[model samples]
Target: MSTERRAPLDRKRVADTALKLLNEVGLEGLTLRAIAKELDVKAPALYWHFKDKQALLDEMATEMYRRMVASAALDPADSWQERMLKANRGLRAALLSYRDGARVYSGSRFTGTDHAREMESNLRLFTASGFTLAQTVRANSTAYSYTIGFVIEEQGVKPLPGERREGYDVQERARLLAEFPLAAAAGAEIFEDYDRHFEEGLALIVAGVESWTRLG
Candidate 1:
């Protein structure tokens, strides 16, 4: 935490600190003031880089994904379905790393160079698998949405800062059990199986994409 002649508040550093703050605080608890304090800079300093809280949040979401761009890999030879599914798993893990990180990240469209790599990789995979440019882009979007949606669901288990879990609506179970007998009997035991659920969802998405390859 040296305040020495540091590089000026670039989006990278600002967003980095914001991400750290997010892990420390949470979605609603996150504030520009908190981010400012983390970077040891005044709130006004951040204004030069981000227009407002939403801009700051969006930028942080993109900045945080700098990890996914690094950690995930794409083999050009791999089938499109395989590559896209790999991305989905990588993304879910990355978003789950920070608190409400998914909420901030999901709606953001800022594709910094790193994010672009992810996009290009998915598109390339899809195109290689015999899909058209339009199909490739659509597949990429579908994979992205599914990954983000998975993260949102994962984040639900660990209550965020300043949130009380007392209000979790278990009553919905009765309606769900009316149809899903296994769900009713399992009760909250399902919460213990995030890994299994993740794999199941990933397989479902991949299977759908695989169908495209088979019939395309």
Candidate 2:
């Protein structure tokens, strides 16, 4: 037999392999066995790293967050509004990067405390800008919820970038709403130009937060 050896299994390697297979098989189709097979190991091998599929998903979301932070050039000098836009935009991009990427991230817990670092920075920014701790938490939570909810629906229509589901055709949607002229006309706004819509919605949220901060 050859003396070559395979790389030892670890949480990051398992999560990374699962993320690759996720794009191919998606969240529903991704299982421990599938990830293990991709890693050239048996299913039981993955169990040592991830107790279950959810555990693997938690790590995957953490990895996605790590990549987002690494790729984003967040500036300390940015205004809270600018920070909100950049952070949410980066989040939306990260969630849209894989098949069911949003789904994979929606409820998964992070396996590490790396997220706390970002949270600390954001809280400090808001507090420095005169927001109370409670206000900072609420503001951050609102924006985070908006980003997650928007991407969940966005991915529902287009599971992956440039790939639309069968029932979400714009013309078909318009036809279905033909009886309601305004609703039919709104189909384009609803389905098309998601990038612009996301930015606009995020801006509205940021504006609201600013107003709330001034009042506080």
Specify the highest-TM-score model's number: 2
TM-score of 1: 0.81
Task: Summing lDDT over every window of 10 consecutive residues in candidate 2, give the lowest-scoring window.
Answer: 72-81
Per-residue lDDT over 109-205 for candidate 1, one digit per residue giving the tens place of the 0 to 100 score: 6745656665677666667657889877766777778777766766776544344244344556656677877777575555545678778877887
Worst 10 residues of 1 by lDDT: 159-168
TM-score of each: 0.81, 0.96
The residue-level lDDT of candidate 1 at 208 comes to: 84
Separately for all candidates shown, the number of backbone clashes (residues 3 or more apart, or on different chains) is: 0, 0
lDDT of prediction 1 = 0.74
Q: List the residue pairs that clash in candidate 1.
A: none
Q: Give the runs in model 1 whose Cα sits over 4 Å from its true position.
A: 1-7, 159-183, 186-190, 212-216
